[model samples]
Target chain A: MIIRKIRGLFNHSVALVASLIMFIPVYLVVVNSLKTKVEASSMGAGLPTTLNWQNFAVVIERGKLLTAFGNSVLYAVGATLIGTTLAALAAYVLSRNRSRFNRFIYFFIIMGIAMPTNFVTLMKVMQLTHLINTQIGIILLYSATSIPFSVFLIYAFVGTLPRELDEAAIIDGCSPIRLFFSVIYPLLTPVLITAGVLNLLGIWNEFLLPLYYLNRSAYWPMTLAVYNFFGQFESDWSLVSADILLTILPVIIVYLFAQRFILSGMTAGSVKG
Target chain B: MKARTYPFYFAGGALALYLIFFVIPSIMGIFYAFTDWNSYSTEVNFIGLNNFRTIFSSGAGQNYLHFIRNTIIFTITTIFLKTAIALGLALLLTGGIKRLSYFHRVVMYLPAVLPILVVSLVFKSILNPATGLLNTFLRNIGLDFLAQRWLVDIHLALPSVIAVDTWRGVGYIMVILIAGLMAIPDEYYEAASIDGASGLDSFWHITIPLLMPVLTVTTVLNLLYGLKVFDIVFVLTNGGPGRATDTVYTAIFDEFSKGRYGMATTLSTLLFFIMIILGYFVIRLMHRETEG
Candidate 1:
C-alpha cells in the first residue's frame, strides 16, 4: 500500500511536469503577446509590467486583420455548408440504396483521404478553370477536398439510423426531395453538425492550399495573413505573437463551446474513416 | 430500398467537383510529368523521363533521393515520438491521475487546435538560436552548453522540426487513445489485480492486446500525416540551412515556386504512387478488421 501510494505520487508529478511543458508555448504566446517588444524578445514567459495593446494595434492595422478573419469565416463556412450538404445527401442515398456503382463511388471518394493534394497539377487545373485566386474558386476546391471524409462520417452515422424513417416518409406521399429536406435531413442534424465542425476546423486551419492557390493579398485567409505578417515582422516578436493570438482566438472560442463535438468528430473520423 | 436515379443526383455535385478539381488533375499530373512544361516555355513539349532523370541526377541542388530520405527519416521519427508520447500521456491521465485529466486534456489539445502556421511561427521565435525562449531558459538554468542554433544547424534542424511536429500532433493522438483506453472495461484491470498481476504485467498482457486495433489505426494515421508533412516544416525552417530539413513535399513546393512545372509534377507523381501503395494496404487492413 505504501509503495502504491509512492508510485501514485510519482505518476502525478510526471503528469504535472508534462502538462506544464505542454502549456509553456501557449503561455508564451499569450503573455508575450501582451508584453513590450523588449520583454517579448528577451525570451521569457514573464508577465508584462504594463498592459501593451500597441503590438495588437499594429498587427491589426497592418495585417488587415478583420478582412482576413472575414475571409476565413467565408471560406470555412462556405465549404462546410456545401461539403456537408452534398456529402450528407450522397450518404443518405448510398445508405438507403446500395449498388455496385454506389459502392465504387464511395470507395473512389474515400481514397482522396490518403492521396496528397497534387498541387502542381491542381494549380494548372485551377488556372484553366479561372479559379486561381477567387474566393469562390477556393471554396469549391475546399469542398471537393472535404467531401470524401464528410461522406464517410455521415454514411457511418446514417447506417445506424433505421430504414423505416425513409419508408414512412415516402409512404406519406412525400416527394424524394421533400422527404430528404423535411424528414431525413432533420434526423441527420447530429452527424451534420459533427461533420460541419470537423470540416470547419480543417478548412479554417489549412495553410498549404491557400498559400498555393491564393497569391493575391486581398484574398488571403487568416492563416495566410498570419504567415505573411510574420514574414514582414520577422524581428518583431511581440507583434508576431499578437498576430498569431488573434488568428487562433476564434478557433479557441469555438473549441471551448464545442470541444466534445469536435473531439468525438475527429476520433470518429480516424477510427471509422 | 429500390433502385432510383435520385442517388445519382444526390452525388452529382460532389462528384463533378472532385472529378474536375482532384481526379482530372491527378491524371494530368502523370502526363505532365513527362513534358517539358515550365513558365519559360511557350509550348509544353513531351520530354519523356527527362524531369525524372534530371531529378535523379540532382539538377536542383537537391537530389530526389535526398528528399525521399529526409521525408522517410522525418516521418518515422515524428510518428514514433508522437505515438509513444501520446500513449504515455493517455496512460498517465487514465491510470491514477483522473482528477485533473480534463484540464490536462484541454491544455494538451490547445496546441493541436492552433493553425499549423500559427504554431510554427510561434515556435520559430521560441527556438531562435540566440535570444529564443528555449535558449534563454537553458542559459538561466546554467545549461548554456545545451543551446544550439536549432533551425540553422544541419544536424539538429530536422530533429527540431520533428519535435515541433510531435508537439502539435501528440495531443490529438492522445485524445483518440484515451477514448480507446476508456472503452476497455474496468473489470479487466480489476480481474488482473485480483489474480495477483502487477501493473506492468496487466499493462503488457491486457492493456496492449486490447488496444491493438486502436494502436493500428493511430499508427496508420500517423504514418499518413507524417508522410505528407508540409505546412509545419515549411513555416518553421522553409527547408533551410542548405536542405537539411527538406522533405519531398517541400522539394515539390520549391520546384513549383521555381516555375519547373514538369519537374514539380514528376515529384508529385512519385509521391502519389507511394501514397497509392500505402493507401491500398490501409484499405485492405480496414476491410480485414471490419470483417473479422
Candidate 2:
C-alpha cells in the first residue's frame, strides 16, 4: 500500500511539473518585456529598475503604431463583415437547397483548408488587384481566405435549423434576400460572432502575409509594425520587448474577454464533431 | 425541407465569391505549378513538370527532402509527446482536483492563446546559448554540460522549435481532450471501480477507447498544423544553420522573396497533394471508428 501511494504521489508531481512547463516560456515573455535593455540581455527575464513607456510610444508614434492598430482593426472588421456574410449566404444555399453548386461549394470549402498560402499565387493576386500595399487589398485577401471556415461553420449550424421558418416566409411572398436578412441572419448570430472573432484573431496577429504583400510603409499592420520595429536596433531590447508586448496585449484581451465562446466555437468550427 | 429555388439565390451571393476568388486561384495554382512563370517575367511558358524537375534537380532538392523529413520528425515527436501528456492531464483534470483544476486550465492555455511570433521571440531570449535563462537554470542546477546551442545550431534547432512549440501547443490539445473526457460518463468509471478495476486498468480500458475520436481529430489537426508551419520557423531559425530547419513552406517563402514564383508554386502543389492524401487517410480512420 505504501509503495502504491508513493508511486501515485510521484506520478502526481510529474503531472503538475508538466503543467508548469507550459508557463515558463510565457513567463519569459512577460518578464523580459519589462526589463531595460542591458538588464534584459545580462539578466534575462529580469525586471527593469524603473518602468519605461518610451518603447511603446516609439512603436505607437514614430513607428506608425496608431496606423498599424487602425489597419488591423479595419482589415479584421472589414474582412469579417463582408466575408462572413458572403460565406453564410453560400452556406445557407448549400445547406437548405440541393443543387450542383452545393456539392461544388462543399468540396471547394473543404479544399480551402488544405490550401496553404501559395506565395506565388498570393504575389500574383496582389499585383493583379493592386493589393500590394493597401488595406483593401489585405482585407480582400483575408476575406477570401476566411470563406472556407465561415461557409463551413454556417453550413453545419444552418443544417440544424428548421426549414419551416424559411418556408413560412416564402409562403408570405418574401424575397430570398429578405427571407435571409430577416430570418437566417439573426439566427446565425452565434456562429457569426464565433467566426468573426476567429478571423479577427488570425488577421490581427498576422505577420508574414503583411510582410510580403503590405510593403508600403504607411499601410503596415500591427504585426508587421512590431516585427519591423523590433529589428531597427539589435541593442534596443527594451523597445523591442515593449513593442512585442504591445502586439500581444490586444490578442490576450480578446481571448480573455471571449474565452468561453472562443473555446467552444473553435472546437465546433474546427473539429469534425 | 421544401423544394425551393430561393436557397440557390441565398447561396448565389456566396458562390460567386468562392468561385471567382478561391476556386479560380486554386485551379490556377495547380496550373502554375507546371509553368516556367517567374514573377519578374513579361512572358511565361508551359514547362511541363520542369519546375517539379527543377525542385528535385537543384541543390535545393536535398533541402526540400530534409524539410519533409524534419517535418515528419517534428510532427511525430510532438504528436506522441502531446497526445500522451494531454491524455494524462485530461484524466487528472476530470478528477476534480480541487481549486487547481481551473487554475491549471487557465495557466496551461495561456501560452497557446499567444501568437507564435510572441512565443518565438520570448524563447529566443530564454534559450540564448550565451546568456539565456534555460542555460542559466541548467548551470545553477550543476548541469553545465547539459547546455548546448538551442536555436543557433542545426542539431539543436529543430528540437528547440519542437520544445517551444509543444510548450505553446500542448495546452490546446489538452483542453480538447479534457472536453472529450468530460463528455464521457461518470458511470463508466464507477462501474469499472466496482468491478475491482484499478485506476490505470480502467483508464486503459475505458478512457483510451473513448478518447480515440478526440485522438484521431487532434492528431490530424496537429499534423496539418505542423506540416504547413511557417511563422515559428520563420521567427526561430529562418531555416538557418545550413538549412537544417527548413520546412516546405519556409522554402516556398524564401523562393517567393527571391522572385521565384513558379518554383514556390511547385512546392505548394506538392505540399497540398501530400496533405490531401494524409488528411484523407485520417478522415477514413475516423470514419471507420465512428461506423464501428
Best by TM-score: 1
Question: Which candidate achieves the best lDDT against the true structure?
Answer: 1
TM-score for predicted model 1 compared with the true structure:
0.96
User: Candidate 1 has which clashing residue pairs, if any?
Assistant: none
Per-residue accuracy of model 2 over B6-60 as CA lDDT, tens digit each: 5555656556655555666556789998887886887778889887776676574
Off by over 4 Å in 1: B57-61, B288-292
Residue B183 accuracy (lDDT) in model 1: 81
CAPRI quality of model 2: acceptable
Task: Please identify model 2 stretches exceeding 4 Å from their true place.
Answer: A1-20, A98-101, A270-273, B1-5, B39-41, B57-62, B279-292
lDDT of 1 by residue, B1-292 (tens): 3565244788888788878887898899999999988989799999898888887886666678888889999888987898899999999999868778888888788778878888888788889898788998898999989998999899999999999999899999999888888888899999999999998999999999999888988899898888888998898999988887889999999989999889899998988888888887877776555335
Q: Model 2 residue B272 lDDT? A: 74
Point out the worst 10-residue segment of candidate 2 chain A by lDDT. Answer: A264-273
TM-score of each: 0.96, 0.91
User: Model 1, A1-273: lDDT tens per residue?
Assistant: 999889889988888888888778778888888888777775478888888988888899999998998999999999999989989888888766768888788778777778887898899899999999999999999999999888877887787788787788778887888888988898889889888887898899998788899988888999899888878877777888898888888888888888888788867755542
